[model samples]
Target: MKIFMKILGIAILIAIGVGFYFRLNDDVLTGDRIIGIAVLTSAFILMPVFLYVRWKGKRLKDYTLSEENLKKMRDKGID
Candidate 1:
């Protein structure tokens, strides 16, 4: 499922790029309108799905500066 979402997100991003490229060349008003809609749809779908797949099963606490983590950071001289 994660792999599928990743692929879908990549595909949508590519589609948006292609649509934008065509949009620059299109002179017809309706053609530009279609490209605009396609780009917006790709963006809306790409963000959430990609983020979900990227962050799925990851703990937010592990990345935060809790007491234990802060101590480790201090030990490493990274803080």
Candidate 2:
């Protein structure tokens, strides 16, 4: 439940970011409406993946996939 809320929050922020980006430059943009919508849709969709990768990368710096980390107990030995 907490993870779901976090993801939802991330998604809303991304949506606002994308909306602001487009709103600011809408006048300069030139293309068919269909093409424009397609671009925006894909870009919005990509934001979540980008965020996930960023989050995972940050977590990786402080953690590892070794057996010790997997067990998540300080007393456990990797071997």
Candidate 3:
């Protein structure tokens, strides 16, 4: 899973770079399409995968603000 995420991230970044290269040196329409597709893929596919990988097996409440958590933070001298 870690290796897959790394490869996906690198591939997306490469696609974006290629998109920019095409935009600068080739047809504007093709370049824009490539860039748009790349951006959409990152937002929809890459982000969710990354989030799942990072948050897997973690309790959501631990990261959220609740009265109990707030009190704990205050006791620790955190604002």
Candidate 4:
């Protein structure tokens, strides 16, 4: 399940990456109206991806920590 989620995330990331490529291809954004719309559409698909990857937890209590440091902090009553 985790791997599946990761793959889905990767797929979105790749789409965003491709969109970024088109978004930055400004020379292609010449006077042609059709080319401009297509490029903008590809780039706009990145908005959902940006939203997904950066979705934080609802509150501070749900944070995660690395195992080694979590243990050390646990021993020190910090976690």
Candidate 4 stretches with Cα past 4 Å from truth are 27-79
- 32, model 2: CA deviation in Å? 18
Tens-place lDDT per residue, model 1, 1-79, is 6777667657666666666666677645655665676567657875677777789999999999799999999999995
The reply for model 1, stretches above 4 Å from the true place, is 2-27
lDDT of 3 by residue, 1-79 (tens): 8898789888888888888888899677888888899899889988998999898999989999999999999999999
lDDT of 2 by residue, 21-79 (tens): 66667633432343455456556755565666568637563576776566665556544
lDDT of 2 at 54: 64
Q: What is the C-alpha lDDT of each candidate?
A: 0.72, 0.57, 0.89, 0.56
> Candidate 2: which stretches are off by over 4 Å?
27-79
lDDT score, candidate 2, position 35 = 43
Residue 68 CA error for candidate 1 (Å)?
2.1
Question: TM-score per candidate, in order?
Answer: 0.63, 0.34, 0.79, 0.32
**In candidate 3, how many Å is residue 25 off?**
1.8
What order do candidates take by lDDT, descending? 3, 1, 2, 4
Q: For residues 1-79, could you state the per-residue lDDT of candidate 4 as single tens digits?
A: 4455566556655655555566577633443444454456445754555555567445434466768668878899994
Instruction: Give the C-alpha lDDT of model 2.
Output: 0.57
Better of 1 and 4 by lDDT: 1
Residue 32 lDDT in model 3?
Answer: 87
